[model samples]
Every structure is written in structure tokens, then in C-alpha cells.
Target: MKCALVLCSLSFLYSQICHSANIVAFMPSPFYSHQIAFKPLWLALAKRGHKITLIQPNVIVENNENITHIVLNGTYDILDKYNHVHSLVEGQSVMKVLYAALEAVMEGLEYQLTHPGVQELLKGEKKVDLFFTEFLLTFGFSLGRSLNAPMIGVVSMDTTIEGHMSAGNPTHPVMYPDRDMPYPLPLTLKERMLNTLHWLVDRVMNEIFLNLQDRVASKCLGQQIPLNDIIKNVSLVFINANPLFNVVRPLGPKTVNIGGGVHLMEPQPLPTELQDYLDNARNGVIYFSLGSTISSKHLSNTTKEVILKTFSQLPHDILWKFDEEIVSKPKNMKIMRWTPQQDLLRHKNIKLFITQGGLQSVEEAIFNYVPMIVLPFFGDQHNNAEKMVARGFGLTLDHNKLDVRTFRSAILEVINNPKYRERTKESADLVMDQPMSGLEKAVWWTEYVLRHGQTDHFRNTLSDIPWYQFLLLDVILCFLVITVIVAYVSFKLLQLLKCLAYKLYGKLTRKIKTKIN
Candidate 1:
């Protein structure tokens, strides 16, 4: 009996050991927001007894035994590149801005790949069970292939048209606009036409840029693998998008929506000074931030003057995230270089969020039931703002047309309006009512992919079909050809029958005439 019990215990221990995996997550994007969105997934994996080696730009995960942080040097300067690009491309077309951004990303990827740590890993000394990385960067896929591990792509923002296309997710531009366009749904004919054009332009541009990345990546790997094949073969994609803020669209079987995953955790305690300020606010407080990427100090002088002047008129106290101190700031306002945004939003005294509509900021606001006054600058910020307005819980303002009068009035209107607050609270409740937290769902799916190996079963059939066949264009042409042939044959047969009848009638008439004579 003792021997049998010992054997069973050993077997159980071995099974548990088998379940644990060595996951290497390569997120070399220089954008801090992307790192913020990806942190929860890596942390959750670390908590679940899996060993993680995260190659990130700005974040460091300290004091975790299961996780090793590999910070890439010389990558932090990407923030400067972002600021320069934003300044240069203020009024440029979305495609142009996207191209500029992608060029920077490619540069960042090249820098990361050249890092000593990354070079060692690529040399195949480490035994990796799973490889995870951002989906937007095509070069990262090569690392997974190099390690001979299953790859899982993570989208740090809402699903993009490129991602949907790559994953074989159904896309209807008429109903679902491109990620760059901010037009509301139930699109007009003109809007639909523009939306279609935007989709095509984006798709073509992505292919060109991605092919370039693939070439660079191929050279680095010392092997030639087609980028398209790598993308299609990814075991799964975990997206930080939910139906609440995202347009309802078909998702592929391997595409997992883990929206609001990072915000699912309880917020940490606010700093003492911020807590005191919020506690003392009798008329409530408005928190304003442009997110981590965009610096408030970079705003033009006129813009800054208008914003400050507008905030002075508001009855509510304001907390602005500014990198530099304002010498003549309003007495009712406070400026902080940084504050715990999630913690500040959780405070009961907080009334509204004035933001740039980054996905992380929007998700945090929605989770905390705070309405927003959005002034979007670029990328998906515009689209996010539009969705918030469509949901009836927020309003959008044009930063270019922003003046003191307009800014002040918008703030007052949102503050005085009870419906916005009510609707936002309702949305928060609905969003939080999911069966499991986003983290839990993410971890479950990650392990599922690990246990089951490649997700061939999860791939959509549409992925394999050509566009002509998927759209039934060929089928439609065949049906039209058959109809035309049948119609022509029937018309000819009818004409022949008519001639025969006429001839028969003529014959009958002659026979009758002869009989009468």
C-alpha cells in the first residue's frame, strides 16, 4: 500500500512539472503604452509557475523569481522619435503618419535584435517552450521560428484591419470602419466609399512595409521564411479589445479578445498628496492627461494658454499631468509630472477624465465609470474618441479648433449633464460583469495553446480561401453565365415554336379553302 501511494504521488508531481513552460516574450516596441498593455499577460504567466524572459524597452519587472527581465539599451530614445514624428505629421494623412511610425518601429526592432542578450538567445542556448511577441512587429515572428517554439501574437490595442486580415477575421468596411478613420457607424455612401479606400490604402501599405521588415528579419535569422506564412501559422492572438469599446466584428478562432485585461486588477493606493487633494475637493475633480507618449510640454504656447485659461473658469478642481511646472497656474488646479492614473480614476471625488483617448486610458476610464472629454491627436485616439461619443458617455473636441471659450463650455456641459455619468456607470457595470477577468481568460488560452500545440483546429477556413472564392465572385459569374445561356436558348425555342404554329395554321387554311371549293 505504501509503495502504491509513493508511486501515485511521484506521478502527480511529474504531471505538474510537465504543465509548466518556459515562455519568452519579445516586446521591443519603444512605445511605453504598448509595454503597459503587455505587462499583465507576462506577469500572469509568471504567477502561474511558468518561467518568462521578457525583452521590453521601458518596463522592468523586479523581484520575480519566475521572470527574468532583459532590458535593451539605446532603445529609450525612441520616445524622442515619437515626439518628432507627431510634430511633423500633425495634419498629414493617416497613411503618412502610419508609415512614419512604422519606420521608427522597424528601427527599434533592429536595435533590439542587435542587443547582446537577444543575440545570445537567438544563438539557441536557451530552451524555450513558447514564444510571445507583439503582432504589429513582423520581425519578432522570426525569433519564434528560430527557437522552434509555437508563436502567439499579442495585439496591445484594439484589433486593426491589418491584424484581422492576417488572422482571416471577417471585415466589412461598410459596417466596421478602418482603425484610422473616426467616422461613426451607419455610414453614409460617401463615408463608406472613403472607408473602403482607407482599408485598401492601409492594406497595401502594410504589405509593403511588412515585406521590408521580413527581408531584414530573414537576413538576421540566416534563414528565409515568408512573413505571410509566419503570420498565418501563429498559434493564437490575444487582443486587448472588448466589444464594449470595439466595433462588433467577426474574430478568428485563434483570436482571443482580452480587452481591459490590465485594468481588471484592483488599483494601488494613491500618493499622499494626491489623496489629500482629492479628499479636499468639494466640487469634485477633473483629471487631464495626454497619456505617456505625448508630452504636455510639447503643446504650442497658444494651446497651453487656452487650456490653462479654460481650466481657470471651471468650478471643479483640475489635476493636469504636465512635465514642467506652470508658473501662473490657476489656484484651483494642481500639476503633477506623474500620478497613478488608475488610482486617481478610482477616487469617488473624481468627476471626469480629459484625455487623448489612448486605449489604455479609455479602458481605465470605462472600468472606473468616469466620463471623458477627449482631444485626440493621432493613430487610434481619434477612433477611440468617436466610439466613446457613439456610446453616449463622452464627447470629442478638435484640438486645432480648441479655444478658451470652447474648452470651458465643453467642461461645464459635461459636468452639468447627469446622463453622461449615469450612462458611464452603466457601461462600467456591464463591462465588469464578465464571467472571468481578462487576465484569467488570457492565462487559460495561453496554457491551452501550450497544451494543445499548434492551433490548426482554431484556424478559420476563410484564411485558406482566396479572396475571389471567399467573396463568391467566381460563383456569381458562373450563375450569371448559366442564366444568360438559359434565357437565350428559351427565347430561340419560343421563336421556333411560333413559326411552326403559323405554318400549321397556313396549311389548315389552304386545306379548308380546297374543301370549300
Candidate 2:
């Protein structure tokens, strides 16, 4: 009996420790920057024995046995070829610029959904405990139903309007700017008007987008997906903005702020050539990159000439993430096809980073206590850059107005200013002071969902309510009807009283007249 009990106990312990769930993550974003936020989370889950099937345009080059990757190879090509950044920098209407971006995203999404690999992955019924996807990729809603799993939206930056509405998070237009709103807080009257307009425009655009999405869904998934069903399936959200670094806002327990440098990992040793170059730079080095989506090659020759001329004049050495070789490169500048950005930031000799102000790049800069200059291109980069300037850790420039004089001046300002460096150190401390690492929080929450079969209890009832009801329009209409009825009754009573008074006054006057006669 003792021997049998011992064996049973051992078996129970093993079962408790090794219960791994099958997770499906559909990340259709074409940009490598978008993948940075959640990449560590999946890997952490894989390390914990969960099997993850990833569907994305960008794949993890690093191999893992528990993870399977399905590449939507043509998606990135579609977005890159669209080339909407120039219009954004040229000060196009916010709505028009965003609409163009939406068009690009839709085109990319069509390619992704129709990809033979993705279609193959979404085939038939499968046992999946949890589904991970970008919050804005509403197409993933259908994927969840197809796989029979609950979804958790992963946002690389701030969550979108759809995500906010789906999760019932507070998204007041002026207070909680949409993912597309680039204006800074304490908005001017002009900005408030524009934001209000954009809010209305966003709803209409979303309707158009949904119509497009529904058609795409029918074509590829062989069924139409209801937006209501999609909203209901979003069990949790992991937004990449750490509250400390972001505008202070209220988020329910279900929406996690996993941003505080989620992508940061242990710094790897830089290549010997790169390391030696950075180490020998007595004047410190500036790392410049336009991030993953915007290619440096796309810059106008005039802009490139200006940037190159500025770099040549700077005393500080330059490490540029240039995809193509420069024919007239400066002696002080070294160009790389790709950069180890995180590790480079970690280097002691690194003084400043010149970037397109991507959130991931900004977070890495903050975490490493580096001051930087931002020339925002598009999307959330503008907001991210504005926040950096507000925090006093960075300076921003208009890419459209970029000249050798202005570019060199801004670079020098950020680098020479002691306060920028000081602010970065303080900000880095606050970011690092979180109770747990972002990766740990992400992994724990992911596993928690897997362990709990039903997550509806965590959802807010506001998400399920119709928009009319959500705004209390029904209540308002009822109140208005009641007020009108009461007002009519009161008016009729006053008229009746007036008639009675007039009759009594006439009768009294006639009685007095007869007595006098």
C-alpha cells in the first residue's frame, strides 16, 4: 500500500508541473517593430512548455522546438510598396493620412489572409487553449472562432479605438488620444476641434474598414465575421505603453501595460568590429536608424544629402543603419545594413541615438539611459517623440524641414545638454522600478488565461452593450419624452386657470354694474 501511494503521489506532482497548453498566435503585422513587444512573451511561454503556433509576416529568426512559425511573406511587400510616409511628413490632413495608412493595412491584410500558408493553418477545427493577436488586426477575431480559443490582444504601442471599445477602456477623445492622433496634451482649441472631427471620422472609417474586413473574411475564411462576436472574444489586452512613461490613464485589470521595455533582453556582445569602433570613439557615437518599416533608401536625395552633410560636420562619430552603401560616405560615419540597437544603446561610449522615434526604440533608449533626437515619420512615432520631448529626454525635428544646419543643431543640442542625459537616467529608474519585468508579467498572464477556461468574468459589461445604450441614449430619450409630457400638462393647466379667472372677473363686474343701475 505504501509503495502504491508513493507512485501515485509522484505521478500527480508531474501532472501538475507539466500541464502544457496549445497556444495559437496570429500576428499579421508586417513591420518587425510591431513584433518586438510580444516576441519575448511567446518565447517565455514556449520555455514554460506551452506550444505556440505563430502566424505573421515577420518570423522569429531564432529557433525554438515548442514554437511553429507560418510566414505571411507578401504582406510586408504590399505595405512597403504603398509608400505613404511622404504624405504624412508633408502635413496632409490627419484623416487623409490615416485613411491612406488604413488602406495600406487593408491591402496587407488581404494578402495575409489569402496566403496559402495562413489558409492552411486556419483549416478545420483544432484544439487551441489561447489565441494571441495584435489588437487592431480585427481579422484575428475569425481566427479565434476557427480555432475555438479565447483571444488576447497584444498592442505594440497604445491600443486602438476598436481595442478600447472592445475592452471598455476609457477612450475620451481629448484625454485618451486615438492611435492616430499625434497632438500633445493640453491640446489647443484647434487640436480639440480636429480630434473631435477625427473621432467621428474614425467611426465612419471603421465601418468602411469592417465592411472591407467582412468581405475579406467571407472570401478567405468562407464565412462572415460579426464585429460583436469579435469584441466578445477579446478576453485580455497587453498594451506596450508602461503607465509611468505614458499619459496616466485608467485601465481595467484585463488590459495590461506591459511596455516598460518589454523587448529589452540581456545585452549580447557586439561584433568585434562594431565593439572596437564604439569603444574607440572618445567623443561618443550617435546611432541613427529610421526603424524597420521606413527605409533610409526612400529618403529624397536632397534629404539624404542634408543628413550626410550634417553627419560629416559633427565631431561625434556616426553609426547609421543604412540598407544601401553610400558612395560619398564621411570618414567619421560607419554604415551598417542592420544594427544591434539594444546592445549598442547599452554601450558606455554611446552618447545619443538619432531615430525615427519608434516606441520600441524609444523604450530601449530610456531603459539604457540614452538621450536621443527624433525625426518622426508616421503612425505613433510622432506621439512617441512628443512624449520624449515632454519628458525632457529628447529633441524632435520635422523631417520635411530637415536641413544640415537644423539637423546638426538638434543632434548637438541633445548630445551636449546634460539635463537630457540626467532626465533619461531618472526616467530609466522609474521604468525599471516596476514590480515585475514585462516579459514575466506577460508570461504569467498568458499562462493564467490558459489555466482558467472561462475568462468572461473578467470582461466589462460595457463592451457587450450597444453603442446607443452605452452612451445612455435610451435613458436620455425616455427623460426627454417625460419632460415634454409634463410640460404640456402644466401648460394646459395654466390655460384652464386663466380662463376660469377671466370668467369670474367678468361675472363680478356685471353684478356690480346691475346693482349701480
Candidate 3:
């Protein structure tokens, strides 16, 4: 009897500790920057005792036991397969690649529905408990349906109109962190026109791809699919932006702004040579990196020489994150293939950051409060850079004008400007003061959906209302039309009465004159 009681107690304890539910986070693009943005969230969950799986093509993890990293090999090679895409030289924007990759993934999914690899993964032996992913990639929705689990979308950018509309939030360019409307509730005529134009562009893009997505999803899932409806049912959204970078606005529990979730790991000691160079230089250090995907080695020799020559003139110590090992690194310059970015950025002596303005780098600078000299290439980088410039935090450089003179001037401006440093510090302070770490907030809300197992809260929220209903413009237009009709009729009646009265007076005067004569 004693043995049986002990066994029973052990069994119950094991079950209680096993919140070790299965989760899969899907990112459509194979970009390293996007992956970095999500790394903290996955790592945090894995630490808390969850069985985690990250699915993408060519993904690498630092190798933790609690998490499983799965790479979908062939499906992701579309980045290289499209030769035209590779040949297209973009400066600093990533939008084109983002859009192209999304199209390719959707196409790949369609192809994979018939392929063995995708089929086997989707047909896993165990059911997934939660599906977490970037909302821009629609595959997570299908995965949620496949596993019958709740979905938590990780937004890679600020909540634009499309993002808000998809999440059932109000449609306006309000500051996300505080959820405050920067402008009036009812947009002015000019605002309405611009908003409509932006909305139309998004509508056109979404419409063009609907048929393609449907066909791809159906072929992959082995049945008919409702891509539109799946997007409509996301349970939670985690935006990768903090309130510090944005104006304060109201946000719901489901849509958490967990910006700066990228874990700022501590720095390891610098390599001896780089340390020696920095030690010798009396001036401060400057870090230059174009992010992960674009290899610095890919730059033409002329551009490389120009950059080198420009840095040679700067009295400051330089650490360049270059792809290839240089034949001769300068006495004051250190070229490294990789560095502990967050760790190095946190160093007090590091004065300036030359970045591609990718969201990950942007968030890091915001987290560390480091001043930036951005060279944006494409997509939201342009927008992100624009915001940084608008906020007085950084200087934007055109990639085409990367001549020595221009580069040197840009670097000098940021280094000299005390205001930029002050603003960056302010942003850092705001980012650090969040109520909960992004990981905790993300995990708690994800579990909340699992425990509840329904969408009652989201369903009742105003986000569920259709765009027409949310705007209430239809009702407003009807009221305006009725008011116009009533005013018009009243004016017509008054005009008619005045004309009749004048005619009567004239007739009476004529009769009196004739009688007197």
C-alpha cells in the first residue's frame, strides 16, 4: 500500500511539471535580422520549460537542449534561385526582398503540399499546443489550423494600417507604445485622401495574392483552404517595437508591444589585437556593420577602398564587421566577421554606429541608446530611418553617395552632435522601464489563450468590428445627406413665400394708384 501511494504521488508531480507543451514559430523570410528579433522570445520560452520548435529554411540556433530548430531546406532557397532578385542591387531598403520572399514562400508552400518534406512535418505524430510566428508570414495561420492550436503573431514592424486592420484595431497612424492618436479622430480632408491612397495600395497587393495563396495552401494542406479567414482568427500579436521609440498609445492585452525583447547579452572580452588598437587610440571607437544578410565582401573593390580610406582619416578607433578577412587590417582598425554586437554597443568608449537601419539594429541602438549613422537600403528601413531622423536621433545617408567625403561628413556630424546622444539616451531609458520583459508578457498571453481555449475576449473587442463599422463613416455620410436635404427644402419654402408677398404688395399698390387717379 505504501509503494502504490508513492508511485501515484510521483505520477501526479510529473504531470504537473509538464507544461512542456509543443510550440512552433514560423518565419517566412530566411533573413537573419528577422530571426534575431524573435530569438529572445523563443529562448525565454525554452528556458521556462516548453518544448519549442522553430521552422524556417537555413536557420541556425546556438544549440539549447530545450528547443528544437528545424530548417525547411529547399523551400527557402528561393532567395538564391531567383537570379534576377540577386542581381538587383538595392542600397539600404529591405521591402523588395521582404515582398519577394513572401511570394516565393507562398509559391513554395504550394509546391510543398505535394512535396514529401513539408507533408511529413505537417503530419507530425504530436499535436502542437501553440503556434507563434511573424504575422507577415501567413503560413502560421495554416499551421495553427493544421495543429488546431492557438496562434500568437510576432509583428516585425510598427503596426501600420494593414497590421491594425488585420488585428481588428483602429485604422490610423497613431503612436503604438501608448496607442494615442497623433491627430484628430476624424481625419481632415487631406488626411483622409492620403489614408485612402495608402489603403488602396495595400488592398491591391493583398488582392493580387489571394488566389495564389489559396491555391498554394490548398495544395499543401491536402484540402480546400480559407486563407482570409485564418488571418482573421489570430489570438495574440506581439509587436517588436517599444513605447520609447513610439508616441504613447493604448494597447490591448492580446496585442503586446514587446519591443527590445532582443536579449542584450553581456560582452565577452575583445580579441587581443582589437583591444590593443583601441588601447593605443586616444580617440573613441566607431562600429560599422551592414547587418547579416548583405556580405561586406560583396561590395566592389572601389567601394571597399573608399570606405577604408574614409575611416583612415578619422582619428577614432574603428571596428568593422566585415565578411572576409582583410589582407592587412589597419593598426587602428579591426575587421571582424562577427562580434558580440549588443555587448560591444554597450561599451562606454564606443561612440558611433554605422548601420543598415534594419529593425534589429534599430531596436538595439534604441535599447543601448547608441547614436546611429544609417544607410538604408529598402523596405521599412527607409521608413525606420525616416522615423529616426524625424525624432532627432540619427543621420540618414544614401547608399549611392557613399564616397569618402560624404561618409566622413556623415560620421562626423553624428559624433559631434550632443543632441543626438541625449535623445538616444532618453529612448534607452523609456525602453528599459517596461512593466514586464517581452518574453514574460508573450508567454503569459500565449498560455492564456491555451487555458481559455476560446476567442470570447477578442470577439467582443472593437477589433472584431468591420472597417466600415469601426469608421462609422457610413452612418456619418447618411446623417450629412439628410441634413442637406432638410436645409434645401426649408430654403426653397422661404424663398417662395417672399416672392408671393412681394407680388401681393405690388398688386395692392397698383390698385390704390388707379383708384386715386
Quantify all predictions' global Cα lDDT against the true fold: 0.81, 0.80, 0.69
lDDT of 3 by residue, 1-517 (tens): 9999999999877644536678877775567777667676677778878888777665556778877766666664666765324443443246666666666766666554445544676777888788877776565577667777788888765565555566766554322211222233356767556556566566567656655767666666744667667766778777866554444455654577766644444357876766665566578899999887666776667777888888888989899998788885566688888887876776677789988777778777767778998876655666667667867788998765679998898899898888898998886776677678776676677667655655647742555565565657789999999999999999999999999999999999999999999
- RMSD versus native structure for model 3: 5.3
Residue 115 of model 2, lDDT score:
78
Per-residue lDDT of candidate 2, residues 378-480 (tens digit): 7778888887888898899988788888888888888888999999999789778867888888887777677676577777765666656755679999999
lDDT of 2: 0.80
| Better candidate by TM-score, 1 or 3 | 1
Those runs of model 2 whose alpha carbons end farther than 4 Å from true positions after fitting are 1-18, 80-104, 124-126, 174-197, 477-481, 484-492
Best candidate, lDDT: 1
RMSD to the hidden true structure, all candidates: 3.7, 3.5, 5.3
| Distance from true location, Cα of 477 in model 3, Å | 2.4
**lDDT (tens digit, per residue) of candidate 1 on 278-348:** 99999999999999877888777788889989888888999999999999999999999998888888999
Local lDDT at 391 for model 3: 73
Clashing residue pairs found in predicted model 2: none
| Clash list (residue pairs), candidate 1 | none
User: Highest TM-score: which candidate?
Assistant: 2
